[model samples]
Target: MERTLLIKNMVCDRCKTTVLELLKTEGFKVQSVALGEVVVKDASKKDDIRLKTALQAIGFELIQEEADVLVEKMKLALIKQMDKGDADFILSKIAEDLGKHYSFLSKTFSQLEGITLEKYLINLKIEKVKEYIQLKQLNFSEIAYSLNYKSSSHLAKQFKSITGMSMTAYKKLQESDRKGLDKIV
Candidate 1:
C-alpha cells in the first residue's frame, strides 16, 4: 500500500527537487513529490520517523495532523494564486476550491496559524512585491496590476506599511532584501 505525506515548507521548485532527491537517496519508492505533499509506496510509521528526522535536519517538516495539513494546503493555494498573478481574497472562491466552508476555513486557519488568512496573504503579496522590485523588470504600476491591487498608489501604501519605505526608496537601496516563500510563515 501507498501512504501520503503532507509536508510543510515545500514552497518552490527547488524545494520539490530537494525532497525528491532525499526520498531517492533514502531508498523510498516515491510515487510523487509535489509542492506540499509526497506519495510513496511501502511507507510505514518507522519510515515516517526516519523521513521526519531527515527533513527536519534540512529545515523542512513532515506534517502529521489534519489541521496542519489543511494549513499547508491553504498556504499552497495562496502562493499559487500569487504566482499566477491572480491574487485576491475571494472567500467564496478559496472555500470552493478547498472544499470547505469559508467560515470554517477562516476559523481553522486562525486557530492553527495564529493569523487570519487575509493577513497572511497580504504578507505574501508584500514579499512578492519585494521580489519583483529587485528583479527590476516591471514598473510599480505593472506590478500593482499583476498583483490585482487597485492601483500603484495602493500598492505603494501597502509596501510602505509593510516595509517602512517608499517603493522608489526601496529600489534605490543597496540591499535587495527578500525572503523565500517557505521562509515567509
Candidate 2:
C-alpha cells in the first residue's frame, strides 16, 4: 500500500532534498517529498520502525498521531500558500482551501501549537517581509502591497509589533532577521 509520512522540520528545498536522499539511501522509494510530507509506494510495518530510526538519526521526525498529522497538514498548507506569494489571502480562505472550517482549524491549531493561527500567519509574513527587505528590490509600499496589506502603515504597525523594530531599524541592522518558512512558528 502507498503510505504518506508527515515529517516535522522538512521546511525547505534543502530539507526536502536531504529527506529524499536519506529515504533513497535507506532503501525506501520516495514517491514524493514536499515541505512536511513524503509518500512511499511500498507497504510494510517493518519499514516504519527502520525509517523512523533512520529519520531521527538525521534530525528529522515522523509524525504518527492523528492530531499532529492534521496540524502538519495545516502548517504545510500555510507554508505552501506563503511560498507561492499567495499568503496575502485570508486564514478562513486558507482553511476553506484545506477543506476544513475556520473554527476547527483555528481551535485545533491554537490548542496544539500554543499560538493562534493569525499569530502564526503574521510571523510567516514578517519573515517574508524581512526577506524582501534584505533583497532591497521592493520599497515598503510595494512590499506591503505584494504581501496584501491594506497599506504600508498597516504593514509597518504589524511588523513593528512582531519584530519590536521598525522597518528602518531592521534595515540598519547588521544582519537579516529572516527565518526559514518552516521555522516561522
Candidate 3:
C-alpha cells in the first residue's frame, strides 16, 4: 500500500534530491517528495524500518503520525510557503490557501507543535530576514516590505522582540555566530 512518510530536515531541494536517491537506491518507487514528506508507491513494515534507519544515518528523521498528520501537514505547508515566497506574505492569504479556518489551524498547530502559528511564522520569517540581511542586497525598508511588514519600524520591533537585538546589531555580529532555526526556540 502506498504510505506517506514525514521526514525532518528535508527543507530544501537538495534535501529532496537526497531523499529521492535514497528511496530509489532502497528499491522503493518514490511517488513524490516535498518539505517533510515522501510518498511511496508501496511500502511494508520492513521497508519502513529500513527507510527509517537509512534516513537516520543521513541525519534525517522519519516522523510517523496518524492522529496528528494534518497538523504536521500544516507545518510543512507553512515551511514550504516561507521557503518559496517573499517575506511579506499575508497570513490571511495563507489561511485561504490552506482551506481551513485560521483560528482552528492556529490552535491545532499550537497544540501539536507547542508554539502558536504566528510565532512559528515569525521564527521562519526572521530566519529569512537574517538570510536577506546577510546577502547585503536589500535595505531595511526593502526587507520590511519584502517580508510584508507594515513598515521598517514594525519589522525592527518584531526582530528585536524575537532575537533580543536590533537589526543593525544583528547584522554587525559575526556571520558564523548567527542563530539557526533550531536555536530560535
Q: Which has the greatest lDDT?
A: 1
Query: By descending TM-score, how would the candidates be arranged?
Result: 1, 2, 3
**Model 1: CA > 4 A from native:** none
Model 2 agreement with the true structure over 110-165: per-residue lDDT tens digits:
99889988899889889889999989999999999989998999999999999999
**Tens-place lDDT digits, model 3, residues 1-185:** 68878887676788889989999999998888887788898788778789889999987877776426556666566666777765555666656876878787777778877888778878888888888889999999998888888899999999999888899998898862455443343
Q: 172 in model 3: Cα distance from truth in Å?
A: 1.5
Candidate 2 overall lDDT versus native: 0.85
Off by over 4 Å in 2: none
The residue-by-residue lDDT of candidate 1 on 1-185, one tens digit each, is 89999889998889999999988988999999888989999988888899999999987999998878888998998888777778765656778988889888889999988889888888899999988999999999999988889999999999999889999999999997788887765
lDDT of each: 0.88, 0.85, 0.77
For each of the candidates, the C-alpha root-mean-square deviation to the true structure, in angstroms, is 1.3, 1.6, 2.6
TM-score per prediction, in order, is 0.95, 0.92, 0.83
Worst 10 residues of 1 by lDDT: 83-92
Model 2 clash tally, residue pairs: 0
- lDDT value, candidate 1, whole model: 0.88
